[model samples]
Structures are given as structure tokens and as C-alpha cells.
Target: MKFNWMFLFTFLALTDLANAQFSSGNQFFIGANTTVSIHGLVLRPTFNNTVWSNKVLTRSPDAIVGEPTASIQQVHTFNEPTSFSGLVGLTYLTGNLNGNTEDDLQIAYFNPDEKYVTTTGSTVDKTIHFVSKNFTGFNNSFLRITATNANSVLPVTLVSFKALKEGEQAQLAWSTSDEINSDYFEVQRSAEGKIWNAIGKVQAAGDSKAERTYTFTDNSPANGQNLYRLKMVDFDGTYTHSKIVVLDFESNMMVSFYPNPLTEKLLIQADDWNEVKSVELVTKQGNVIPMNNSKAGSDPGSREYDFRKYPVGTYYIKVTRQDGGIRTQQVVKM
Candidate 1:
């Protein structure tokens, strides 16, 4: 079921991918917009969307690899059920690593059963090159960067961080698999993704190998476009931030459609579906985009739409409530 890369010895920089498996490649470039949301562990890169392959899967690391006993600080799980035995390289920006000492960092590969596999990476200017050979391959393996301190290790293994509107307040929640020299987590809020103000803080586990859960409530969140991020601070005052979770209440409409620049799927959330009569897609040209993957979104208050089949353009989603109430939102598919 695997197809070899059409090009024998060249690397390609694709933005988005739906369904196509290529062979003879272990290099992935995550640009400024690279969005990695593996099982609620979201990493929205400072860059735009880059290449992603289903075969080469990645998710937040679980409790299996807890302690850094093998010269590995943390591991990022990828390639489930698919073994890798060659080159595995990741090129990322220096700003994203949150490193106190980038000179001590290098990429390391691990086997499926939490065993240390061998690989090394180096930095060049603001770009880091984690390119090396992996002699052994296993399913459900890891692609990790060696860490010199607690600041660098906190991010890759974060379990999940989410934000939601709860009745009249905004709720922020997150969890961690392992922590080192941890002090506490400060929940910060911003009006439009800048000028953040610390809203609340929660105690951390300091140094623990167990899973820890944390939550903070912002009773007075901004009216709309509220940006939330966790300022994870260690005891030494070193800190790192999590991926920003956006909650927009700008619209007066009851139904909420997420990710204006639609990537793979568009999620529509509502408080209640009992009053919702119908939902469908509309184009700017008054054309209808019939969805083959309709009825996709599950229990987010509404249905999820797989807009991949349609061409890249602007579209409108019309929601008709039972009592003749109507709302329309514009979305652009990238």
C-alpha cells in the first residue's frame, strides 16, 4: 500500500496533504505555520502549515517513557505501526525550542518499547538540523531532541491543553506527563494574541514522573478573540509557553465555526442542537457544495465538515434554527 517517491533523490516542501503515501523520505519541514495537533497536544508553529503524512503519525507522548534514564529528556511518538530504519530529520526554528542551552541539544531516535535508538542533530544559525541515521526501526517509535534542562523538556511530552466557554466563564485546562524543576503554571490571556496578562496560576508537581492535570478559570475573560497560553515556569524562573488556544465570541450568532482558514476540517459548535433545523454549505457564487463526508463532526455540539474535496475558495455556512433564526459565517479553505 506504499508508493515510492516519484523523485528519487530530491526533497519536496508541500503544505497540506489529504491522501498520498510517499516512500524513501524521513525528512519533515515544519515552517512558521506548521500545526501539530496530535491527540489534543497542539503545536501551532510560528510558521504556516507544512507537510504532514498519515503514515508518519505523531502524537503527545504517553506515560510509557517517563524517566530520562537513557540520555533522552523526552520523546515524541510517531509512525504508529510503521517501523523506521533510515534517516529521520526535522528542521525547526530556534525560537520554538525554548532552549536555555541549545548547544546541548541534539535529536535522538528511540525504539517502540522505550529503548534508546541513536541519532544526532546540530544547529545552524536560527535553524536546527536533526538529521541522522536510525539503524533500528520499530512501530510506535519516537523522534526526540535531547534536552539540557527542564525548559526544553516540558513541551514535547505535554498531554493536552484546551480552552472552552463554560456558561458565563472561560475554562483553561492542561496536563503533563513529566515535570522537572517545575514551579507553577500561569494562565495568561490576551485580547488579540498579544500583550498577555497573567489571569491565574496553578501549582505544579515540581519534579514528578506521574501524569499531572491542571485547570484555571478566567471569570472575566475578554469579550471576543480571547487567546490563552500556559506560561510554564520552573523553580529557577525559566519559563516556556504552550500553544495558544483561541476562543472567539465576537459573533452574536449562537453557532460557532472554527479555523477561518479551513485546513482539513471545519468544526461548528453550538450550545444546543435541539433548535437547529439544518446546516449546509454555500459558496460566494450562490453555488452549493454538496458534502460527501457530511455528518462528520461528532458531539462538538454539531456536525464536522470535511471540506477537502472542494476547491480552495471562500464559502459560507448557513445554519437555520428551528424558530426561523438564521446565522451565516464565512470560511476560507486553504
Candidate 2:
């Protein structure tokens, strides 16, 4: 499956990587047409259960089957669908420096998912850095890595990220542009914002260049607050994280009124704005005032009530949800 054009998004920075060579005491599964040379660059796979890449790049010191340029490139064929990523360390003195300045260098790459050549790379002390994007659901494919002077772009361009609470689950939806595109999206969750765990993975549109949208659901969210972010991994091993999205899950918190002691308008927001059926205001004189979203230009998701017309006193806000549940909040319009 070939794409219209490969994206070359090679932005350079600094990141220390593993050793310069495929070190000793390591294992590799070299399939047909696969070659490796020592002295620089090692592609090793992680074998952890929860964090598995589904494959490994063999690190062999006694590897003597490939040409001298094996330090700068590796060609291999996969037997099954695999997603792998690793850093390659290439020095400038080894005759592979195609450009004098660092701006003219990039890793010319190819994989089953890519179908064509897209470039990405970085450098430190003239040392070239190559990391492969995760290849998802591609098999019997040849991966080619070489050196070149070109620009790269990420296949998928994120357009937006959003979150909302539905019935009993937290649903996250995101949109992307020109996604010729990613391998998969790992949905992550956090409680205290310090620790995060992978909750689910959504398969990417490995070969699409249209406006694409994807969604994931957290069926079991905490009672109060839940944090979410997307681990967006591309086919060539490049990865990035999306902005954090928060969803509040509550049972009794039907209505929330802000600026209790306000001189302006009082804003009323609900757990699910669409679920709100009606709103009522109670005055100190036991007078009932029917309310609508009075805040000028406020979105449909919020309700604004004009409290400036009333004098300073204790007032009450009553809200009825679509499910027939009701909650009232007391406010002061000072």
C-alpha cells in the first residue's frame, strides 16, 4: 500500500542514547536479507509484558555478515506484524557524512507501513540519531535505512483533542489532518497527574491521508477526576504525546453555581450540560423564578443567570436533570 507522499518531519534536538554499537551478550533474530555490522548503532527490542514492542532488533558483536556501511544502515524483513523503535548512533568520521552542516542530514527510512521513503534524524557532536517509528499490522515487509539530505514531516497532523463524560464512561475523541499516517494511539490515564498507565490502544489509519477522527472509551473511571492523554506513535518510530484532557465523574454533584457572592451574572454548569432539563431560582421571599441560560453569548454547554438585577441577599439555584434527579445550590447575590 503506497502513499501519495511521505512526510519528513526531522526536527533536531539532544537525547543521549544506548551504546554506539550492538554490544556483547545481546540476542537478535536476523531474518532473510537482514544484515548488521558492529562498531555503531544497535536496534534492541523491549520484552516487558505490559510494554512490549512485539519484536526485537538483534545486537550481535560477532556479526560479520554485512558490508562496512552496516554501521549507518540496516535492511531486514519481518515475518509478522511488528512495531519497533530504537536509537541508532552514527558518527561523522566513518565516511557517511553526506553534509558538512547538521541541517543537511537526515535518516532515509523505509518500512512496510511507510511504503515509501520518509526521512527523520538528529545529531550530537556530528553523531547521527535514528529512531524507527512503530510499524503496526504489517508483515513480510522490508525495512530500509540509509543516509540522505532531506526534510521530513510526521505523517499524521493532529487537529484537535477533546474529552467528555457519557452515561458511565469517559469518551475521548481526537481529529487529525493529512494522516497518511500513524501506527496506533495508546490511551493513557492518570489519577494524581504524577503516575500514568496505558489503558487502551486504538489502531491507526496506517495508510490514509484524509481528515480522520478516532475515539477511545474508559469504561472504568475513578469517581471524581480522571486525566487522559494520547501516546501518538508513527510508523517510523517517532512518537509524541497529546495535551492532557480531564473528565469529572460524579453522582451527587448535579449542579454547580459559581460567584456565590457576585455582583454580575451567576454561571451554572452541570456534569453533562445536555442532561440538564430545567433550572429555577428561589428568592429569599419564597418567590420561584424560572431560569434559562441568560449569559450573553455563552455556549450551549453552560447556563448564565442574571443576578445583577437582584439585591444583596441569600438565594437558591435549583436544577433538574433529564433523569428526573434534582439538586439545589444556595448563592448570595451581593
Q: CA lDDT, every prediction?
A: 0.54, 0.52
Which digits, one per residue and each the tens of the lDDT, describe model 2 over residues 246-265? Answer: 66674465566776677888
Give RMSD to native, each candidate.
19.3, 18.5
TM-score of 1: 0.37
TM agreement with the true structure for every prediction: 0.37, 0.32
Please write out the lDDT profile of model 1 over residues 6-71, one tens digit for every residue: 221222324112222333245444444333322211233332323345535432223233223223
Worst 10 residues of 1 by lDDT: 7-16
Worst 10 residues of 2 by lDDT: 2-11
